[model samples]
Target: MRKLLTLKHWKNTFAFIYKLLMSKEVAVRDKLLFLIPVIVYWVVPDVLPLIPIDDIAFTMIIAEWFAARMGRKYNIS
Candidate 1:
């Protein structure tokens, strides 16, 4: 949890995400698994208006989850 507050951790997370998205080795379908929901959430925040989290916060959380899952699945560092 403490790591999440650091700028370096976020920079690395975003870098990993950018790398994953740009890699041809990862299937489009696999990439869509991360993209679709994030796009939807950003485009349609009212879908879950009860949630207090901000849009960027949601994206970061999903980004972290996606990075972890896809990294393991694709054996990416």
Candidate 2:
């Protein structure tokens, strides 16, 4: 999607990730959600005949979602 690939979107996403990692405002439970994907991506087999998608793409989408949620919850720009 165009919205996802924009420079502004990436900037905001990275900013939120940095802020979340740096600040203690977010709960540990929520941070754990991010780890699940990483674990699955590495632990699970990456071969599928029908599905043709990259792990990095899924990770990016999840990152964007996390960033938006963090920004909304913390009222951070």
Using TM-score as the measure, the top candidate is 1
lDDT score at residue 13, model 1, on the 0-100 scale: 96
Question: Compared with the true structure, what per-residue lDDT tens digits does model 2 show for residues 42-68?
Answer: 545454434455677777878888887
Candidate 2 Cα misplacement greater than 4 A, ranges: 46-51
Error (Å) of candidate 1 at residue 8 is 0.6
TM-score of each: 0.89, 0.71
Positional deviation of residue 8's Cα in model 2 after best superposition, in angstroms: 4.8
Question: How many clashes in each candidate?
Answer: 0, 0
Q: Model 2, 39: alpha-carbon shift in Å?
A: 3.1
**Candidates' C-alpha lDDT:** 0.93, 0.74
Which clashing pairs does model 2 show?
none
Q: Compared to the true structure, candidate 1 yields what TM-score?
A: 0.89
**1-77 in candidate 1: lDDT tens per residue?**
99999999999999999999999989999899999989998877677687777889999999999999999999998
Q: What is the C-alpha RMSD of each candidate to the true structure, in Å?
A: 1.5, 2.6
